[model samples]
Target: MRILFASSEIHPLMKTGGLADVSASLPVALKRLRHDIRLLMPAYPQALARAGKLESMATVTLPGFPDDPVTLLSGMLPGTRVPLLLADAPRCFQRAGDPYRAMDGQDWQDNHLRFGLFARLIEHLSLERTPLGWRPEVVHCHDWQTGLAPVMLGMHETRPVTAFTIHNLAYQGLFPRHAFDALNLPPELWHYQGLEFHGQMSFIKGGIAYADHVTTVSPTYAREIRTQQLGNGLDGLLNHRAESLTGILNGVDYKEWDPGRDRHIAANYGPEDFSGKALCKTDLQDHFKLRGTSGVPLLGHVGRMVPQKGVDLLLRAAEPLLAAGEAQLVVVGTGSSALEQAARRLAERHPGRVGVHIGYDEGLAHRVEAGADIFVMPSRFEPCGLNQMYSLRYGTVPVVRRTGGLADTVVDADPAGLKAGDATGICFDAALPEALTDALTRALALYHQPDLWRRLVRTAMAQDFSWARSAEAYATLYRDLVAARVPPGKP
Candidate 1:
């Protein structure tokens, strides 16, 4: 099948979260399965700078928004067979230093317009038969940034089947209804069942309503989103289209994350050769300025620091954990000033016990995964977390909130019920600080048992959640969607 993937970010070129990792790895896996896959993303200055010496394609004009002629840039993904198409529009994309951020750390207010243009451009490109005669049989749209692509495809009678995957529903691309006039959408599409959402234009709502199939990142999340607690106001719509909704768990790129081959960490070690991991732990302690200690359990967390991440709860439980004097904490991420300040304050209060690196460092994150005895991800609502999977791959037991993909992945460590070599990680149902403390205490208690800890690590390392499995599932879905479009007698 010929598939065109539209996303806001892709790894190695641009990234802020797991969406980039998925956009980068999924295509490669699908390509390996012999599907013709191509990736499309905005050619932000950073991306263009990183994607050096790529060939440029002919200019194409997007009809809905005037004065912006979308230029197509072509490149081969490094070390892969997949082709990449980057939409170049400097006036809209190049104004910012980061892909979606201004110099002052504020999100660009015109993000709705920016991504709307990108979505329309992707739709136009997908529908057009090039002079070289290239067109996609299916267009896979990711998140709210590319949500309008499916909506636009629905408007076009000749367009291919569309699939929209919601990585997170909380970030629906919403703007004032007046912006619909700027979008120049058809009059019939302005209602609630279309792009409109409670007097505003919601890109996510449009995708959910118009796409042939809608998917979330995990089965648990897909079921969770149908309820008021997790829906983010789209529960009713999802409930109405329950038959079309599916949850396919996200997969990790083993090549990028495998402990056997990762070059980012200080030492490389797999399940069999686990001795090098201790060196990685010491390296992590030095990097984070935590006092190097062999006996103390080093807990690691690598993600955006926000209430959604349960960083607030983590903060509230920090002092108690430090006072227990059983473990040390090392956190790596940047988000939400309150969490940052809280992390900094904790680091100050317990100088050697808490280490806080207030920004993202890919190398440091890998070291932390390799070094830490336990990894914590207490997200209040995670769509499908990749960090916990990474931690598992590195033999770091995850301590997570039993929500979304976290619940799908981590097995709660039960002392009495757990078999010798079966337990993987710790889990808690509540998002409160006390729940986190209890979960941490349970993990700490397990850490005292050397045989149990080793067994848990080995169990986690043995788990497989690679992209090849997910690619096969996606292939089945694509075939089904394509078959629906073809006539019964047609070849």
Candidate 2:
């Protein structure tokens, strides 16, 4: 299969969240399955620097983009042989603190324009408009950044099979109705059933409405988005397109996350011998200045400190435990000022019992996974969280809300599940702080039972959530979509 994987971000070169990680790993996985996959992303300065030994491929211009000639650079993704295509439009992508946000943390005012041009680039690549003459049979678009690709391709009578994955529906790229004029899309796209959402132009609607097939990160999330509560106002359209929707759970790249050979952690350990995990725990305690012995359970949270992550709920739920000296807390992330301040205040109030790191550090993230007795992810709505999977791989039992991939992956440590020897982690229902607190209390009980805790850790470590399974699922989907379009004798 010839696949064009389009995403706004890719890991190692550029990353803001799990999307980048998925964009990087999934293609490599597909390539391992013998498919010819090419990654398409903007030529951000960071990406250009990291993606080594490039060859200039072709140049093209979009209808409305004044940046007349966007050069396409071809390179191999670092550490993998998968072909990488970079759309080099310096004025649009070069000057960035992150891909979507300015240095001040405000979303870039011209995001619609930035990604609109990107959508056109995807169209060009999908249609084989470039001089390079290689066309993708399947163009798999990720998130709203590449949402317009399916929309653009949908206009043509003959085009490649398109699949769009909604990483998160909450981030629908909406712009003022007037902004659509700048994108130079057909006037018909202004209709309510098209790109228009209420009075705004929604970039995500392009993919959801026009793509041949749609997917979300997890099966639970696929069902959740069809409801009014979690749909973020797009439930009707989603329900309308229900037959074509799917929820393939995202897989963890164990090569990077496995604890046995992780270079980032203080000590390497696996499910069989957890002695090194104790040294990692002590090192984590020393690093965080937490004055807790290995006897006390150390809870860990690593992600954006935002309301959606249930950071507020985490603070409220864990404070009582932290204050009582029953357990210790260590949080690492950067997000909303209020939540960041609250985490710092909790650390201050409980001095040696709480630790807070305000920004992301990959090495520190690994240490937290390796060190913590339990991992906390009380997301109000998680699409498919990777850290919880990382926690499981490191034998750090995850305490997660029963939603999305967390629901799909982590088996609740209920008596029935434990008795059947199937429990991997702890799960709680509801988004309330009390629910999480109660779940944490249950985890604490389990933590005190050394033999049971060790058994649960081993169970978690033994569970497989590798990319091979996910890649196989994707390969099946691609073959199905492509087979429908191509005649039996046609290559």
Candidate 3:
């Protein structure tokens, strides 16, 4: 099947989080499965400069917004056979540093206009009858940034079936209703059944309302988002489309994350030897200037420091845990001034007990995964996280909040020891500091029991959450969607 996978970000090109990783790895995996897959994203100046595809292709202007003509650029994605189409419009996309941000660290206020335009361009390209025909059988939209694609397709006279995947529900791309004219969205789509949300235009709602299928990262999150608590206000719409909604758990790119071949870490080790992991642990300690001790369990967190990630809970639990001195903490990744300041303060208070790196370092992240005894992801609501899976691959037990993908992935340690060999990590219910404390205490206690800890590590490492498996599942879904399009008796 010919598939057009649309996402705002792609790894090794423009990545801020796991969405980019999924966008890049999944398409490559699908291509390997013999399906013709093409990727569509903004030709950010940085990406173009890196890929060496700055030259312009065809310049096409939209109907409503005639003043802005978007230039299309064609290039092969680096390290992949799939073709890439970049929608270039310097006024809309060209900015310093990151694709989504300026050098001064501010989001482009015209993001709504930018992405909406990209969606419109995609619809036009797909529906246009050109000599180089490229009509996709399936148009897969990733996250809210590209959510407008499905909506635009539904409004158009296009035959391509649309699929929308919710990587994160919290960011729904809600813009003022007046911007509707700028979007060039049809009048008929203004109603609640389409893109309307309250008095604003919701990109995510449009995708949910119009797409043939809606998917979240994990099955448990698929169920959770239907409830008011976790839905971030889209629960009603998701509940209405519950039958069409499916949760497909995301998988990591084992080639990039596997400790066996990772050159980023101080030492490379796999399940066989396992001794190098300890060396990595010591290296991590030395790197962070923390106490280089193997007896105390080292817990690591690598992600954006924000309330959504439950960083506040980590802060609350830090002092007590450090005071107890049973375990050490190492946090990587940066976001939210409040969280960064708090983490840094905690590190200052307990020098060797807490190590906080207030920035993103890919190499450091891999080292943390290999070295840490436990990986902590206390997210308040995680759609589908990749780090926990990375931790599992690195033989690090994950201590996660029992919500969204975390609930789906981590099998809690059996209290009665009934499922001895199967348990992967510690899972907590409440998204509070006390709950996190309790879970940490349990993990630290288990760390002392070498046999149990080893069993947990082995169990986690044995699990396979590779993109190859995920791609196969997606292929089946795509084939099914295509088969449904066939006439009743036609082969």
Candidate 4:
């Protein structure tokens, strides 16, 4: 099978979140299955710097984009033989800071145009116009950044199969009406059956409305987004297309997350001999400058401090626990100015008991997973969470709200669940602070029972959330898609 995976970010080259991790790892996994997979992303300064040797391939031009003659660069993914395509449009990507934002947190005003050119590049590549000489039978896109590819593909009389994965529905890439004029899209796209959502044009709606098939990050999320509460007004479209939609949970690259060989943690241990976890706990406490013994429970959090993640719930739950000195909390993330300030204020209020690092550090994230007795993710809605999976692998029991992928992955640590020997972590039903605290309270109580706690840790460690199962599922989907694309008279 010949496929091209398109995403805004690719790990080790450029990254802002789990999308990059998926973009990088999934292709590698697919390539291992003996499929010809090509990876496509824009040439951000970071991607260009890390990309090994680059060969100029072809130049591209989009109708609305004034920046004509954007160059394309071809290279290989680092440490792999897989081909990589980089759209070298300086005006669009060669800005300061990361791919999506500048040094200031505000989005670049011309993002619609920026990603417009990127989608155009994908369309051209999917058509095999470049010198790289590989035509993709299937073009799989990720998120709203590549949403326009499906819309653009719809215009072709004989185009390859297209699949679009919605990583997050909340970020629909809603652009103003004026931007649509700048996009130079077909006027018919302005209708509700196309890209238009209310008064604005949605980049995601383009994919959802026209793609050959659609996917979310998890099976539970696949169902959730069909509801008014979680769909963000796309429920009708999602429900209509439910037959073509699938939910494949995101997988972790255990080579980067495994505790047995992790270079980031203070100590390494496996399920058989996890005595080193206590040392990691002590080191984590020391790093946070918290006064604590190994006996004290430590809760860990790593992600955006946005309301969607229910960070407010986490804060509210932490207040009672931190005030009573029941446990120590360590948070590592950067999002929402108000949440950042609130996390710092909580740290200040509790001094040594609360440690908040208002930024992302990959190494520190691994240490938290390896060290903390409990991993907290109280997301109001999670599509498919990666950290909870990492927590399970690290033997750090996760405390999560029963929603989306969190619901699919974590097994609630109720008495019946434990007795049945299937419990992997703690789960709360409601997305409320009190619900989270109740789950945490249960986790803390369970922590005092050494035998039960050790059993739970081993159970978590024993579970597998690696790429193999999910990759096989994707490979099956790709095969089905390719078969479906064949003409009725042909094989």
Candidate 5:
């Protein structure tokens, strides 16, 4: 199979979240399955800096795009043979700060035009086979940023089958109603069935309405998005298009996440022995300036400090938990100004017991996974979370809310599950602080039981969350979509 994997971000190239990791790992995994895959993303300053020796392929000028010309750059995905394409338009992508945002947290003003042009760029490259003589059998779009490709492709007489994967539904690429006219999108796309959503232009709806198939990151999220609670206003449309929806769990690149050979952590340890984990714990405490012995339970969290992330729940529970000194909590990554202030304040008040870092560090993330006795994610809703899977691989028991991918990945350490020797982590139903605290209480109890803790860790390590499984599923999906689509000759 030949695939043009398109995304706004790809790890090491440009990453704001898990989508980049998926964009990087999935293609490499697919390539191993004998599929010819090409990765496409913008050539942001960060990506260009990291990209090794990019060769210019072609220059692209499209109708209604920004005046700046887009130069297509070709390279290989680092450490892999997967072909990489970068749309190099300096004015559109070479901004000072985050890809989607300015120095302040507000989104870039020209976002609609930028990604509108980007979508057109992808469509042009895939349609024309500009760089090389390889045309894709499937044009796989990721998230709302690439949503326009599928809609535009559906109108082409000769075009590859399209598949769109929604990494997170909450961000639907909504622009003001005027964007439809400003960006010069066809007036027809302003209808309810196309890109328009409740009088606003929604880039994601383009994919959902026109793609041959739609997918979310997890089976539970696939179902969750069809409901009003988690849909973020796309539920009705999703429910109408339910049959075409599929949920495939996101896979972590175990090669990068494996504890046995992880160079970022304090010590290397696998399921076997795991003695180095103690040293890692000591290092974690020392690094956080916590005066705690290895025996104290350490809770680790890494993600945005938002209400959705359930960091609020963690903070609420921490008030009582940290006060008693039963455990030490360490958190890294920044978001939500109020939450960031709250975290800093908590850390300041309880110096050693509560350590907080307001920015993301990959090395520290790996250390948290390897060193912590319990990993925490109390998400109100999650779409195929990667950290819980990472914690499982690192033999760090995850305490998570049973929603979306967390539900699919973690088997709660209940009595029956424990007896079956299949319990991998602790799960709570509600996203409330009480429920989270209860799960943490359970995790602390399990921590005291060394034999049980070891069992859980071994089971977690034994579980396979590798890309091979997801890649196979995606390969099968591509084949099914291609076979099921109307033949180029007929319709």
Candidate 6:
């Protein structure tokens, strides 16, 4: 299979979230499966710096793209043999703090133009119109950034099959109505059945409407997006195209996340033994400036401190337990000024029990996974969270809200699950503080029962959420799409 994986970000190059990790890992996994998979992303300064030596492949000029010809740069992804293509349009992607945001945390004013040009590059590659001479049999697009490729491909009488995966529906690439005219998208695309949503132009609709198949990060999320509650106003269309939509749970790259070989953590540990985990916990406590013995229950939270992640809910729910000195909490992430302040305030109010860091640090994240007795992820909705899986691998029991991928992955530590030795984490049904508190209570109870906690931790560590199976699933989908491709001039 010849596949082009298109994303706006890639790990070690430019990463804002899980999409970058997936873009990096999945392609490597597919290549390992003997597929000729190439990764495609913009040539941001960070990405160019991290992506090793490169050769100029080709230059492409797309109609109405407001920039010089895009220089296609070919290289190998850092630390991986997978071929990498960077659409190098300096004016669009060369400057950035993150892919989507600037240094001051504002969305880049020209995102529409930046990603629009990237989509054009994908179109050129998919249609085999560029001098690079590599035509993908299938182009897999991720999130709203690459959403326009499917639509552009659809304009041709014949083209590669397209698959679009929605990482998060909340980030639908919506622009004002004028952007449609400004981008010179075909007027036909501005209809209700096309890229238009309400009175605005929606980039995400290009993929949803034109792609041969649609996917989300998790099976539960695939179902969740069809409902009005989680759909973010696209539910009706998703329901209309339900047959073409599917969800495959995102897989973790064990090479990067496994505790036994993790160089970022304070100590190394594995499923067979967790002696190093105790040292990791002590190190974590020390780093957080908390005075706690190894026996004290330590809870960890790592992610953006945003409403969707339920950071506020976690803070509120854990207060009583922290005040009681029954547990300690350490939080690592940055988002939402209000929530960051709240977390810092909580830490200040409880000097020894609460600790908060305002930004993301990969090493600290690893330590949190390895050191914490319990991992907390009380998301209102999660597309396909990787941290819970990481925690499980590190023998850190996860307490998560039952939604999206969290629902698909974590088995509740209930009596039935415990008896069957299938319990991997604690799950709560609601997003409220009360629900999280109850789940934390359950985790604490299990933690106090040393034998049961040990059984649970071992079970968690034994679970496999690796990329081999996920890569195989993607390969199958690509094959199916190619098999079903309409013959040229016959459709």
lDDT of 6: 0.91
Query: Residue-wise lDDT of candidate 6 within 1-491, one digit each (tens)?
Result: 88999999899888778998899899999999999989999999988888889999888788887455799999999889999989888888888588888999998877888888889888988888898778889999999999999999998977889999999999999899877888888888889999999999888988898999999999999999999999999999999999999898899999999889999988898877779999899999999989965567999999988899999999999999988888999999998999999999999999988889899887889889998999999999999999999999999999999999999999999999998989999999988999899899989988989998999999999999999999889898898888889555663
Superposed model 2: Cα runs more than 4 Å off: 487-491
Per-residue lDDT of candidate 2, residues 1-491 (tens digit): 88999999998889888999999999999999999899999999999999999999888887788654799999999988999989899889998688999889999999999898999989988888878788989999999999899999998877899999999998999999878998888999999999999899999989999998999999999999999989998999999999989999999888899999999888899877889999899999999988956578999999988888999999999989988888999999998999999999998899999999999888899999999999999999999999999999999999999988999999999999999999999999889999999999999999999999999999999989999999999999999999888889987
Error of 4 at 239 (Å): 0.9
- State the lDDT of candidate 4 residue by residue for 1-491, as single tens digits: 89999999998899788898899888988999999998989899989999999999887675567655688898999988788988888888888988878798888888999998889888888887766677888999999999999999989977789999999999999999998888888898899898889999899999998899999999999999999999999999999999999999999999888999999999999999898888898888889999885467999999998999999999889899888888899999998999999999999999889888988888999999998999999999999999999999999999999999999999888988899998999998888889999999999999999999989989999988889888899989888988888867874
Note each model's CA RMSD in angstroms.
1.3, 1.1, 1.9, 1.3, 1.4, 1.6
Model 5 global lDDT (CA atoms, 0 to 1) = 0.90
TM-score of structure candidate 6: 0.98
Candidate 2 accuracy as TM-score: 0.98
**Each model's lDDT:** 0.87, 0.92, 0.85, 0.90, 0.90, 0.91
Off by over 4 Å in 5: 129-131, 486-491
Off by over 4 Å in 1: 129-132
True-vs-predicted CA distance for residue 247, candidate 1, Å: 0.4
Residue range 101-142, candidate 3, lDDT tens digits: 666677777778888887887777767632236788898998
Candidate 4 lDDT (Cα, 0 to 1):
0.90
Error of 2 at 82 (Å): 0.9
Error of 6 at 453 (Å): 0.5
- In model 4, the Cα lDDT at residue 283 comes to 88
For model 4, which pairs clash? none
lDDT string for model 1 (72-173, tens) is 889976667789988898778877556777877887878888998998887777887334257898899999888888988887777789999999999898
Q: What is the lDDT of residue 107 in candidate 6?
A: 89
Candidates 2 and 4 compared: the better one by lDDT is 2
Model 2 residue 343 lDDT?
94
**lDDT at 224 for candidate 5?**
96
Residue 286, model 4: lDDT of 87
Quote the positional error of residue 149 for candidate 4 in Å.
Answer: 0.5
